[model samples]
Target: MQTITVEPLAQEHIQILRLTSTPHLSGGLDTIAPYSVWITYRLNTGANQHTWTAAVSGYRVLRNGVTDMDAASIVLTNLADQDTTPDWLTDLIAKYTPSW
Candidate 1:
């Protein structure tokens, strides 16, 4: 299990969790495209929140860190239709909302 340091619970103004799946591309050459996943996360603002979903490749994520889930190659780059909640994430949530 990997870990990422995010904004402390008290300092955090927003947070989001997203699930994504990469589609299998079948083709010879020109038609082939790098595998990518469509992910969505919940953005919790101090006053409001929303969800943001996008189709992105693992390379992009590694190249550009995506919040606390950054550099999660094995976790984010794999092909699967499921949800993964890291322990750190759970802890973070609990820290913010003790009752949850």
Candidate 2:
């Protein structure tokens, strides 16, 4: 079973400052243990075709007491400036790559 929960750490009008993810639990990616799960959502509202601004957005690998996979401090850039990925996020992606 896999689950992802989002909690607003800080909000400002239509722009959220610090959005965080709850403890994500999964059986592992394709039978692997201790894997990272990262999820992304669209910020565009389809009603009138408008997009909201988010100052921060990312996933944190929840563990018992390990900061090695924790991404709570990572802040994502805007969509246009997202060409370069953050080192921390990249690390988690590599660590959790499905081996199956």
Listed in order, each prediction's TM-score against the native is: 0.20, 0.22
- The 10-residue segment with the lowest total lDDT in model 1: 24-33
Q: Best candidate, TM-score-wise? A: 2
Across residues 8-100, which tens digit of lDDT does each residue of candidate 1 receive? 332222333343443322222212122433333444435254333323233223223332332223222112422443343333344443121
- The 0-to-1 C-alpha lDDT of every candidate, in the order given, reads 0.33, 0.33
Model 2: number of backbone collisions = 0
The best candidate by lDDT is 2
| Residue-level lDDT tens digits of model 2 in 1-100 | 9898976443222322222343332222211122233223333333332222222322343455333433333333335434444454444434433322
So what's the TM-score on candidate 1? 0.20
Shift in Å, residue 45, candidate 2: 33
